[model samples]
Target: MSQAMRSEVAESWHRSAAAGVDVGAESSPITLPEDDLVEYRAAHALAPVYPLLDDALGEAARACDALLALSDHQGQLLWVTGTTQTLRRAEAIGFVEGASWDERLAGTNAPGTSLVLDRPTMVVGAEHYRESVRPWNCAAAPIHDPITGRILGVLDVTGGPDVASPQTMAMVRTAARLAESELTRLGGPIPVPHMIDGEVFVRADVTVQCLGRREAVLTVRGKAQVLSRRHSEILALLATSPRGLAGDELALLLYEGDVPATSTLRAEMNRLRGLLGEEVIGSRPYRLLVPVAGDWNLVRALLAAGDVVAAMRHYAGPVLPHSDAPGVVALRENLHGELRATIVASDQADLMAAWTRASWGADDYEVWTAQRDLLPATSPLQPLVRSQLARLDLEFA
Candidate 1:
């Protein structure tokens, strides 16, 4: 189907689902779960994780006179802003990072419905599925990235349940537009786009700025870093590969049919290492800098896609920030294969073990659940997983 038609169907689904919530009114609100590991893990691992955009545009979203930013895609509230009263009301109605708003999970509401509809939307109180959601006026507008024009997220403004003001709707749209503008400004036209794994960087004039698939950078400071043609080409190559390249591999990628000497390739690596630093390359495996963790471009995609094999394959090595040698390419390939195979072989029981073994603060129920769901039933995992999940139910309950 055409993109437009599909989008229409999605929006229709949202509107019908949110039919009864009393959105724009003043009333006592509901309770939300405290910020905890379950909430953080789910939010952190969900598809379209917007840390980059959130970090960049949070201040503006908060400062907007009548706007709040939220993620409809994941059925979580994401972020909220505007007057203190409005925020309190929104929070009470279960619009937070960890709360589920899917019509399937939590009944009808703004975010889940908006995502189902794939369009901007407004949802009022009793229009909500749960009676607890009967107070609050919420209007939201979808925001898109200028480059790819994909729906990045929705901007929302919620107020007193009884308030039916048109200004609220207008304000939500305005905030969404402002957010779109900021996204564009943050990602500007670039002569050289840096592609270090998925940490894509676009040089404006002098300083290098990072970019993602959907957002733009427009600030003057971001525009100052202009990169050379070769640099841009090199960055792009590293960004797409499943494994890191050695000096010869990088040289082959950059040089193509031509055969560059080992020494010549070493010179380029040294120069790149000097400029980008040891953090971009690493002593182990002598690989290029391609961040596998934190807020990099591929991370959100990996989370959303929910393909652990692909994700593990992408993590070819410890994000080597400096080394590049011909011999290192083999090691990079081996690690990629190892990680993918390991994740593929893991079951829910193994996943819980992995989570248990992770750093104390990083053990997340979301990740544990996700890993569990992905395991094949025949993979010698079900019995052990059942036992662990049973234990978890008792512990959390």
Candidate 2:
């Protein structure tokens, strides 16, 4: 779209917000660069969280707190923090649930606008495109997954016109950091074992586990306990990564601390297969029994919780030999790239939150370091990371 046309559209959007009309249907008269904006608005109108998020939003609303609401990468509004009254208004204005904060939809505001600018921002009064919202001011920052570099969503604070102060924005930023800290905790992938019922915990059956506080392993028909040490290791590794390992790669990983000969490796795999049975084992490359995806694991559960850091803990070790295999190695690297990309795209607060957790040697320190190396020194996460490393050094010494 042309600059003049874009400006016109932006102005129209603001007008629509002022008029308290449905912007999604009329936002077309105003035009801009992002086609996805309309789509986002329609999608965002849906509620992302129900009664659970209502509690936080309710608290903020009740307290008449200055607050912000956030969404996930898919643009699902996942969290709301700050004043109870403002949160209620935000929810009433359709900030709850599957809302899209991407710039194309909500013009210059905390959630949608910040995602577009890819930076922190404050949208006050006329700056907002919607008419009914013209009286409010909002500030926002974007959050990202440390490894994936994918924008998780915008962290925003919204309130009455007067409440939109620098102090309020600072408070919103702090809340955003807490949310991002939860994201940091989800950075790693971990094994989640399922509890088996009356069934046998034997070698032939594939086992899936529950990762909750009461942990247990289960199978299709019954409980199983026939897995050998190496088999158990393989299960645990795949459980963590959710990506299967090849025979040679698994061999290398199995021999990491104790180097086993290739033949021994083959024997161990054969024994593992014998226990798993041919039915559970799939085709070539990933010839192991029980496909990795079959396991729900802790990481998957954590991801569902909106905590990216917890999901990351399941990575176990570097695939197999942590080498460059198509299965384990490739997935590991993919996750690493995801982390870097997501972190790169995140707002300063989000990046620092991630750095704070990772730099402290939370998951695999070496892996965390490798990911950190990808960022430039000027990156917002740099200072926090350096501080954390310094603290770690002091603590270890």
Candidate 3:
């Protein structure tokens, strides 16, 4: 760990060292088989943007004997593009698609370090943690979910010392942003990556987010899709009702006064099934075949785990705030009440403070008062708390 190493690279080196990676390993240790790699890349979170990346970086990569590699959030390489000579040269060091370049397995490298920090990073020759990687210079940037800010994957350029230039950094970084911009227009997956043995790995799950936001975001197996209000309501109802709902049962919950015709509900269900797979929504009771989780569920779980701060972070706001469906309305009020009660009961001043700052809780007298009680008498925040409580009192009066 030389002070000559840039802080980010130095930090990654430390992490790579501590992870027990074999510093002497010549090639990346985690390589996916060719056929499996093909299928995996085709279904990857970055699949949609591959052609764009290829067109954007393909020529530039070949021009300078550099390779553009797109990796999943876990640093598993999905696409590696270069000219004949360049590709052959890179394969000498196992820099190919279907290999994991994560720091723990490959030691410190551009794409690996980018996933670790979730930011653009550059590693010049000899700055790399592994001796074998020291000859190549690379730059990488993490691509994220446009809405929720989850890291989806990484974009990297690996080649001769020319790859270390700021221009190379700018190109790779810009390409990463462009890919996310494409995702914003076209829906992309809400990928979730986890840490294991100091490595990032993705586990599949279906996530349906209908809280706070007017439109719901549904993600299945790393693919995200925005839903219409009706579909959102349907999912909210179906998710909450685990045992499932019959056509009439769902219609009643969905409608305001009278239950709609079975045809209407049938059409909606059919469309929803088309969007989320026919296997996802089952019949005879119309249950969710896959276990779905989302911000709403995560909040409940965090609260149960007694991590109130984390729960509040995930809360976003009441579930399906704009939905007037009987089931959704009931759900909205209950979850809001539970969250508010939890905040008031907890003695953590920070929790109360955060609650009071939210738009919905700005005038909440109860939470402000709870916050006032939690703050120490000598605390500097007392005046602000007192003023909010006083303002709440006048508003209530």
Candidate whose lDDT is highest:
3
Residue range 152-222, candidate 2, lDDT tens digits: 45656567754567865665566555554554454411111222111111122344432221222334333
Q: How much is 152 displaced in model 3, in angstroms?
A: 12
lDDT (tens digit, per residue) of candidate 1 on 7-37: 4334333332322223332222222345542
- Judge candidate 1 at residue 356 and give its lDDT: 35
Model 2 score (lDDT): 0.46
Runs of candidate 3 with Cα error greater than 4 angstroms are: 1-203
Per-residue lDDT tens digits for candidate 3, residues 121-206, read 99988888888888899999999766545567899999997887999999999999999999877865533322211222223367
| Local error of candidate 1 at residue 173 (angstroms) | 1.6
For model 2 the local lDDT of residue 300 reads 40
Relative to the true structure, how large is the alpha-carbon lDDT of every model?
0.45, 0.46, 0.78
CA shift of 77, model 3, Å: 26
Q: After superposition, how far is residue 31 of candidate 3 from its true place, in Å?
A: 35
Better of 2 and 3 by lDDT: 3
True-structure Cα RMSD, model 3: 12.2
Instruction: Let me know the TM-score candidate 2 reaches against the reference structure.
Output: 0.34
